[model samples]
Target: MFDFLRDPQWLWWLGAALALGAIEMLTLDFMFLMLAAGALVAMVAAALGLNLTGQFVLFCLSALVLLFFVRPVLRRRLEESTPLAVTNAAALTGRDALVAEPVTELAGTVKLHGEIWSARPQWDGETFAVGERVRIARIDGATARIERLPA
Candidate 1:
């Protein structure tokens, strides 16, 4: 294991790093890509005739720099709290839905996005008719709060 660490070939390390990065792309997770970058740095150091200890140190340093410093900045730039409604399940949050089942009182269920969701009228006085269009106010966890929408 340690003997292979002394080899001055970059192919193995580069391949491993690229493979990890590709996997990360599919998963959309950052950790694997960081590790892959660390491995790449180690690969380059090894190819430059650096000792095993030096290569390992380079790998650790690069990995920490990416994980601690780079990832947080990247996350701040790219983070999306509410992703676009690409799937039917996600579309229910803001779309108009009908009260399939009568929610006689303050609590009831509405059918939206081809699924039933627990709903409550936004205002205490507002009453929704069955089959009426109600705009989803917001989604909190499994519940979709709704309010009557004007025509």
Candidate 2:
């Protein structure tokens, strides 16, 4: 095995390509995969009896092309295919809540989506009586801004 590698320099290039491909699997960033593709191109050049310098040049050119062109397209496609997830305070907007206490502009309490939350009226001087329904307009720090629901 050692003697065969000495006779065929292309074997070294192929081994390097395989190593890079394995690293690509761990990273999942596509950068190592592009480098692996370049190494494979270098392996082809070595098999065709190109000098070491020529093989190096082929590898560099191939890697650059894949990094600049192919990588961006692949990244964009992956991003576009992924679904957007709503989380945290953004998830509470426009939801319904029940006034757990007399909700006034100053301070109050409500049950929002089964969770007790600090709340305040959406408008100045507005208030909600206990057991009234309200809509969550937005979240402000630890408080929910609420508007009274239509009768």
Clash pairs for candidate 1: none
TM-score of each: 0.56, 0.75
Give the Å error, residue 40, model 2: 2.6
lDDT of 2 at 111: 97
Cα displacement (angstroms), candidate 2, residue 68, comes to 1.0
Candidate 1 worst ten-residue window by lDDT? 81-90
* lDDT per residue as tens, model 1, 84-123: 5576445655688889866544677899868898877776
Off by over 4 Å in 2: 1-11, 25-27, 47-49, 149-151
Give the winner by lDDT.
2
| Candidate 2: tens digits of C-alpha lDDT, residues 1-151 | 3443455779888999999999999998899999999999999888877899999999999999999999999889988998888899999999999999988878789998788999998899998899998999999999999987767
Give me candidate 1's TM-score against the actual structure: 0.56
Best by TM-score: 2
